[model samples]
Target: MLNRDWHKTYRMPEHPTLDQRVDWHLAHAIACGCREMPDTIKREIEKRGLAVPERNRPN
Candidate 1:
């Protein structure tokens, strides 16, 4: 479960349900592992201003 308050730290609005956020986060995690993003997924994360933490970046 995600901490609701953590959204503020991520600069993510709480408008979307937690399930929606989790879904996107999971997809993003997969993308990060590959060290590549398709245009569509790239745009989604950019629109949300989500940053891939260094820890999550492909090693």
Candidate 2:
């Protein structure tokens, strides 16, 4: 699960640009185990009632 609250929890890069939210979210998702990401990683993805599984699921 990509911590949606990464902006609050992780140390953001210095001088973040105005149009970098998607990159930020995608990075966070990858860190959390979102391997097969969709075409976009914006608010819509999170708001569309989708889910990202955590790492190491019991198989």
Candidate 3:
């Protein structure tokens, strides 16, 4: 099982921006083995003119 509260353990940047938060979530989600990406991450990616990739699942 994944730890949903993992994000709370980190010290957020002094001026936390949307991109920073999205990066944090993306890292934690990957560490927790989440196959689906969050909406925030998706938005961040699109905002930077990037394409959405397929979800990665562990075997």
Candidate 4:
């Protein structure tokens, strides 16, 4: 189920910085379940040693 409300409210920036991408993905993980974070983003997060939110984990 797409979270239209969250999408409408939280558009990704045209040219996002690394921190912005991380923040957006973290928030999106909590607010919506439309899709998984992209592999590139996952790798970046891992490189930074940031913990993915619990809700974002695949079951």
Candidate 5:
């Protein structure tokens, strides 16, 4: 149910669809959460110019 504006915000111009952009970001976010990134995944998101907010999601 993605609307045009939502699509616009999430879509990457270089990518074919918003889903592609979302998939990339989701992987990045997961990397951030993988044992807090420092002890696990490489920190590429900061290089990509993103600062993921450290807010815990409600269960």
Candidate 6:
């Protein structure tokens, strides 16, 4: 189910930096299950050698 309340509370910023995108998506993975993290964001995270959060992992 979509978490409309979470979406309303956590809008992504315009032209967000990579750090902001990563942080927002990580939080979203915990708070909402509406969608998968974007591939671009995942690539950037891996490129930076940062571990993807456990909650964001695919089943």
Scored by TM-score, the top model is 4
Decoy 1 TM-score against native: 0.32
Best candidate, lDDT-wise? Answer: 4
Candidate 2 residue-wise lDDT, 1-59, digit = tens: 33445435654468855335445555565565333444555444556564543332212
lDDT of 1 by residue, 31-50 (tens): 44334444555566566677
lDDT of 5 by residue, 1-59 (tens): 22344445554458436445444455434433222333111344454566644522223
Candidate 2 structure, TM-score to reference: 0.28
Off by over 4 Å in 4: 55-59
Give the Å error, residue 54, model 6.
Answer: 4.4
Task: Give the per-residue lDDT digits (tens) of candidate 4, residues 1-59.
Answer: 34877889999899999889888888888778468887787788888998776564334
Pairs in steric clash, model 6:
none
Query: Is 4 or 6 the stronger prediction by TM-score?
Result: 4
Better of 1 and 4 by lDDT: 4
Alpha-carbon error at 45 in model 2, in Å? 7.8
lDDT of each: 0.48, 0.48, 0.62, 0.79, 0.41, 0.78
The whole-model C-alpha lDDT of candidate 2 against the native structure comes to 0.48
- Per-model TM-score, in order, reads 0.32, 0.28, 0.42, 0.72, 0.28, 0.69
Off by over 4 Å in 1: 1-14, 33-59
- Summarize candidate 3's per-residue lDDT along 1-59 as a digit string, tens digits: 33545445654488979878666555654555354676877888888887655544555
Q: Give the TM-score of candidate 4.
A: 0.72
lDDT of model 6 at position 6: 78
* Higher-TM-score candidate of 1 and 5: 1
Ranking 1 against 3 by lDDT, winner: 3
True-structure RMSD, every candidate? 9.1, 9.0, 4.7, 3.3, 8.7, 3.4
